[model samples]
Target: MNGILNVLKPPGMTSFDVVAYLRGILKMKKIGHTGTLDPGAAGVLPICTGKATKAIEYLTDKDKVYRAELLLGVSTDTQDAYGKVINTLEVKASHDEIERAIKSFEGSYSQLPPMYSAIKMNGKKLYELARSGIEVERTPRDVKIHFIDILNITGNRIVFDVGCSKGTYIRTLCSDIGDRLGCGGHMAFLVRMKAGSFDLENALTLEEIKEMAREGTFEKMLTGIDVVFKDYDRISLNEKDKNRFLNGGFVGLSEGKFTPAQKIRVYDHDGAFLALGETVSDRNGKLNLKVDKLFI
Candidate 1:
């Protein structure tokens, strides 16, 4: 019952909504999503259940890829098309111009989270303040943009793909791209493609999950917690060493195996996950592993 699930969340349900639904379906009291996707967004949302919830922080650092469509000449107060229209403009940019604008957004850049976002402002969520007709100065945040490529540009609609770090707002990205084109824009739709190793292709929708549960095959939908730990370095521990490592001690390493001062994953003799450990060497040139977080 403790594992990870890649749920393909549909639009109109908050990230928490998905968690609640899965918690009820699986009858598991503990469940959580690795990252939050807006209620208006749809994507590969990774849910951790039972003991797997302890590894949520490791999954959050994974890169995310998105497919977004922007509608030119219209801007909404919420930045996405899910909100009321607060301003309108005339479209003038051609398809080529729009493509160029999207290219300019590629690579590292900072963005200011929109007022309608869920970002916290003075212990209160910004969206709550936005709904109350209150406005506050929101400083821009440093977000990484791996790349931006135009997928399709037909008429006033521009579809593009973006790979970025966590906390990136695709809505603001579209807004910034539109500003460079001088035609203004608002995101019409967004579909996340990848979050860590999980992708839309391998995701199970809400309907699919329920179907599987009814068929007594729901366990197949849940993945092992180690799947989410693929990004970390793996270490195989022998029985003699496993006992030592479990007691908060480090094991010796061979030359050219792994560099010192690295966070590594320790596995039991049977290849079961033990816990996360950090490796360090003493001034006397002796290597030791320190238990950072132990599970077994």
Candidate 2:
């Protein structure tokens, strides 16, 4: 219970709901989710158990991929299909026009988050304010669309796949794509296919996960701790260096090993992850690595 679980979070359950279920089944309290998924969205959600939760930040910046459907005739109050219908519009656009509009968002652009989102505004959750019939001016944030593929287009329904950075809102994206085509649109459905290195192919559903816990095979689906550290530059230490690292002291690293790097992962013997550190130049004109963050 000390690793990552590739859980396929089903629709209608929030990220916290998944962890609470695991807590009841496994009877452990130190469980956390690596990322959050909306209640209406379903897909791969990495659950970290025991000490693995300490390393969640290491994977926060990893790219994510999602497959979603967009309905392009009207918009909603929450920007997704699950919300209350507050607006309707006529569709006077063609499939080719929609495809061309989607092509325009191939790179980076500014996105204005919806009013019903969880983003914080004035020390309170935006969704909380939206529930009280209050609307505020939301600032547009910059986000990158690494890749976007038009999966299907028929009549008024459009489907696509997205590879984007963290915090990219699919509901707002679909709305923008529709707006660009001179029609209204909202998120019809969404399924996250990939988060960092974990894919949905090996994801376990909620019932399957609970069954695994009952069958005493819960640990079988948990991934190794090192699996999440794939993006860092790994540096191995010998017995002596490992002792010094465990004793909490700066160690001199080889010159030109990781030049001009801000963060790197340091591992001990047998490939046990130890700490994250930054490289600095000492007064002796040599490279010295110091721990910026570490775990027990």
Candidate 3:
């Protein structure tokens, strides 16, 4: 119960709903989802349980891949099909034009987040203000679109897969593409194909999780918290230093070549993963390992 679950979130259920459902099944209150997926979207959602919750921030910082369908000639208030149609026009752009327009966005750009979003302003969620029939000027944010692969184009519909940094709104990307093609558009469908190291193919549905739980094999579906930091170098501390490290004390490191601020996976003498530590120099310039996040 102290690991991450690669959940295949079903459309129509909010991200919080998935966490609550898992909490009821696992009967544990220490549960959290790494990132929020739109209620109308479906796909990979990593759920952290118990001590794994501490890794949520690291998990959410990873890039995401999404499969999205952009419907040209129509625009909505919410930027997705779930909202009311605010504009419509005839599709006049050619397939080549559409492709070029979508591919042109595969880089850094200032993106205006949709008004009907979860972003907060002055202690009120932007969506709350939009629901109250109010509109506010929102500053555009810098978001990176790693890549956009156009899968197919049928009439006014274009299906594409996008790899992007965190906080990149696929809906907004679709809207911008349509605008570039001279016809506004909206996101018709979306599915998160990947989130960091988690992929949709390996994700489990709620029904599958419940069945596995009944069979007493649900633990097998979990990914260890230490696995999330596998890219970092590891350091095993002796018993004497391990005790001090667990008590939030920095342990002296006389060996190992490490950068000034390099992150490392920490383990105890018996090979139990203990915490995420970073290499630091004390006042006297002595190298020491300090805990970034404690897992034990």
- For candidate 1, which ten residues in a row score worst on lDDT? 287-296
Give lDDT: candidate 1, residue 170: 94
lDDT of 3 by residue, 1-296 (tens): 78999999999999999999988888789999999999999999999989999999999898999999999999999999999999999999888888889999988999999888889999999999999999999999999999899999999999999999998889998998889888999999999999989999999999999999889898899998998898899999999999998888989887657878989999998998999999899999889999888997
lDDT of 2 by residue, 143-223 (tens): 999999998988889899999988789899998987887777899999999999999999988889889888999888888
Query: Each prediction's TM-score against the native?
Result: 0.95, 0.94, 0.97
Alpha-carbon error at 238 in model 3, in Å?
Answer: 2.0
- Which has the better TM-score: candidate 1, or candidate 3? 3
Provide C-alpha RMSD values for all models, in order: 1.5, 1.6, 1.2
Return model 1's CA RMSD, one decimal.
1.5
- List model 1 lDDT by residue over 54-105, tens digit each: 8899899899999999998887888889888877888888767777778877
Top model number, TM-score? 3
Alpha-carbon lDDT of model 1: 0.86
Name the lDDT of candidate 2. Answer: 0.85
Which pairs clash in model 2?
none
lDDT of all predictions: 0.86, 0.85, 0.93
* Winning candidate number (lDDT): 3
Clashes found in each candidate (C-alpha, N, C closer than 3 A): 1, 0, 0
